[model samples]
Target chain A: MNSAAGFTSQDSATRISVGDALTPEDVSASSAVAAEDTARYALMLGDDCLILAQRLGNWISRAPELEEDIALGNIALDLLGHARFFLTYAGSAWGKSEDDLAYFRDEEDFRSCRLVEQDNGDFGKTIARQLIFSFYTHELYSRLVDSADATLAAIADKALKEVDYHQDHAAQWLLRLGGGTAESSRRVQAGLDAAWPYVEELFADVEPTERLAEQGVAVLPSALREPVLDRLHAIITEAGLNPPEAKGAFGADRSGRFSEHRGFILAEMQVLARQHPGASW
Target chain B: MEETDRNAPTDQVPEGGVVTEDPAEHSVWPLWEVFVRSSRGLSHVHAGSLHAPDAAMALRNARDLYTRRNEGTSLWVVPAADITASDPDSKGGYFESPKGKSYRHATYYKQSEGVPHL
Candidate 1:
């Protein structure tokens, strides 16, 4: 791969975005340590992205069209990048690495809300799941940009821009699917019906984040409920479908205990890392 | 690898493409030509083509296909069907008409007499 076109290897390597910006690497290199509560909160956010990213990654080659495959893959990578940032910062409090937090953790140890762990049923269902989570995350990160913790603020600032696009992508698909045809509308509505019950878990104001929110280091998830739901209902109506009226499912908490899909997701994700513990290319 | 019926499900189209039992579900999306500007103050150049349901989806698909590696600062996706292109068969016709017509060149006019910014 030596350069025959006159550019040096150094130029090739250095031509990547050489801007001063927050990255997972930058987070890892800093002397900043997350307080115990902050670390736990970081894990909750990180685990959400990590698990959902795996779910989205399954669509790489399976999407209906080639263009959609790349679109989903890009989003999966964006979520994975956010996961890296949060998990890396969370690891700082415990002297572990991002990989350690991501791969070595057990299902019950995870703090991610159930909304992200839902199956990607049809494309309609996937977009339905995406619409809820993206809208919720977009709202969460918008307020988190002003967090008391500098590290959390920086991470939120960086992740928000991507989350903005994620919400748009989900919304576009939602509108298209919900308005395309009778069958299309029906399936997407079914998707919303299936996903709506889990929406409550996203705003539970979980233990660590609840305390952090009081200290102004985290955005209170409960505060996001009305706005997110209002927007979701408006968009669903605009798409000509009734928003689901189902109650939030029974164990609407981030406990990971009631989640039927989390263990199955983790087994597939963790098997390779466990089988070949320090293996690398 | 041997080729088999990659799409034979009862719900899928029998032969055309990946549309489903919904007979009105268009099998193939329209193609779009994507143009990307590498940075500001630069004209967009053709990057590639992709299939999308409409103009908005075309723009997004263009973004995913062409701008993945920081290659673009802006994107433009035009419906491929809408663009009127010069005939490739015109290589020896109209395009060649201006090529060898040296009188059409401004280079022949040795710089304007007193044009300051020419």
Candidate 2:
């Protein structure tokens, strides 16, 4: 809402204050398109966080160590927070609620990337998954905080802070397991190799991604790829390790394909909701 | 900061029976104690413990294990073995016996519950 910071020209012409900036009239024809685009992008992001939160949540009372169980639980809560904001925004565009977006949508209708839905394989694999996703999200959120849409910018700004902690958590685990005993180092490297092909999908330029970038509703994932890779390289170097080259063929439509791992993951994730209709805790 | 040149050996088993062993022989890492300062200009308070292979990794593990949800702004990690405590057997004779000494108590001379003469 502070025009001088990052508001679009179209937004600036309509209002002078934060509250006024969100008024219906201030959302221009182009801005409405941006909001629609924002909704779609938010769903994609919300699904990523939701799925990852589910995966991390499963680690509670089951982590390799007690300390790690609590740590992973906290990270899951942070991701859930991000999911809440993004899904709330998505629902707002359609005159719905966050609960409707999260509960009513079918699995096929979900827009998350496949990486998040893949099962939490091993402790090493989970850390590897977190390392890749957190770094990617951190870069995206950093650039997205400067978005032209006020609500999107606000969400991005808040998420960026949370994602920084998430990235640091993953980075620390990566260094520890990668540089430690031979078995740990080997296993963690194997996990990275398994996760690498999915990493490329994260940067692939897709239609929704392109449209959202044009309207200033989302940061282009491709633009953030370089910095994310550079950071990964630095962490790997610091850890005295190398990620194995990615194996397996690249799948089409990164968002469309779920690996062999997702079935079990979804069964566990959706079980409680499916079992209890309209249940409140 | 320069790495402190500790006269203390990096690999020796401490008096308390805490020892570091190669990963080939031992599966678990040595425990490290964590301290966190919640914000700038605050004293570090004892947080918890975690395990890691070395000091750098220990510090990192501390960050992840202790400060995940913005609970801390700064962290300090020390191998749990490095900390020395006075013996519990000595507590009764050495610590508790000294508590009642008149000179040490600040409240020995009580002030009235009013604006006191400075």
Candidate 3:
């Protein structure tokens, strides 16, 4: 519950103490003034992590095993930490706090991709989604460590280590479920097919992200598609599973327009917050 | 500490042909003991125990359970069965000698007070 380090008074007071929270001193003076594009870019990454964390949290007591419960819970907590930091930083651009942004925003106002918004179908399906997303995040965050924006770079530096472990967790699960039993292999393949269509939305070039990438404040999503896909392809092949040939969901915009599952997710997540505004435990 | 006969015969098993349970039939994973090193001065202390199928999963589980609050920099997970503990009944015989050995303590050397780095 340590206060996030580098944030100003205007930033959300949410306590997110993962690896050293970016203190105010960590952010360069030039990076203090967040551009409109930078804030929007942050929103995209933050929303993605926030929604995925919520989905992962659903597996706390319901995972296939107890050890898996702890594993998923840890990953969910780490994602929540990343989400809090990004949302706090993004909120600083306007007068909004993290709570105001997360709880008050409507479904269309969220900027997360369809990959994260997809429902956690089963253990295998969740693993499939995690494998894809974690691989993408690993590549994205690895590049983001060199960002011109110091705060973003610092966040990425801490996030990269966590994402590496997350990637390994998903990969291990994928291999086990893919090779363990005939029924398990079938379910895992089905899970991969179910989640494959949403992968394309993750690498789509959005205007705000593209603009920020030009300024060296963000990594370009389109630039990450090839390497991430290559790594995922290798993992899927090594797991003895056939790569799904399903077509990507077309023309789906992450900025406002979301998948059908997002509304239900938001309703569950934002319900208590919207119900009792300004109430604290 | 008092030493009991370590090779004492067990009375729990009677002479009658009683059914012995096989350990392999149990499907549960083996337990692992977790130790976490919090800082430079602190040794790896026993955090808790968890069940995992293998060493890799045990280490990962240890990380998830013990280090959630950023409590440690390093972790060590050993199979619970690998550890050997002294019999609690033999505590008196094992630990008795160190009790009155004030000469073994650095505080016993009172004349070294003026030393820079005793």
* Best by the lDDT measure: 1
**lDDT value for candidate 3?**
0.84
Q: Write the per-residue lDDT of candidate 2 for residues A245-271, one digit (tens) a residue.
A: 665346634445555555556666667
Flag the better candidate by TM-score, 1 or 2.
Answer: 1
Candidate 1: clashing pairs of residues: none
Worst 10 residues of 2 chain B by lDDT: B15-24
How would you encode candidate 2's per-residue C-alpha lDDT over B1-118 as one tens digit per residue?
Answer: 8788666555565766566556437667778889998777889999888887678767766776766545677989988888997898887876788776887787776676886684
CA lDDT of A105 in candidate 2?
71
> After best superposition, candidate 3 residue B13: deviation in angstroms?
17
The lDDT values for all models are 0.88, 0.75, 0.84
True contacts kept of each: 0.64, 0.27, 0.45
**lDDT of each residue in B51-72, candidate 1, tens digit only:** 9998999998888898876778
Q: What is the TM-score of chain A alone in each candidate?
A: 0.94, 0.83, 0.90
Fraction of the native A-B contacts that model 2 recovers: 0.27
Model 1 residue A225 CA deviation in Å: 0.9
Q: Estimate the TM-score for candidate 2.
A: 0.76
Provide a comma-separated list of chain B TM-scores, one per candidate: 0.67, 0.67, 0.70
What is the TM-score of each predicted model, taking all chains together? 0.87, 0.76, 0.81
lDDT of 3 by residue, A21-130 (tens): 55333332224656678888888898999999999999989987788898999999889878877777787788566788888999989998888888898898999999
Deviation of model 2 at A153, angstroms: 1.6
Write down the C-alpha DockQ for each prediction.
Answer: 0.46, 0.14, 0.30
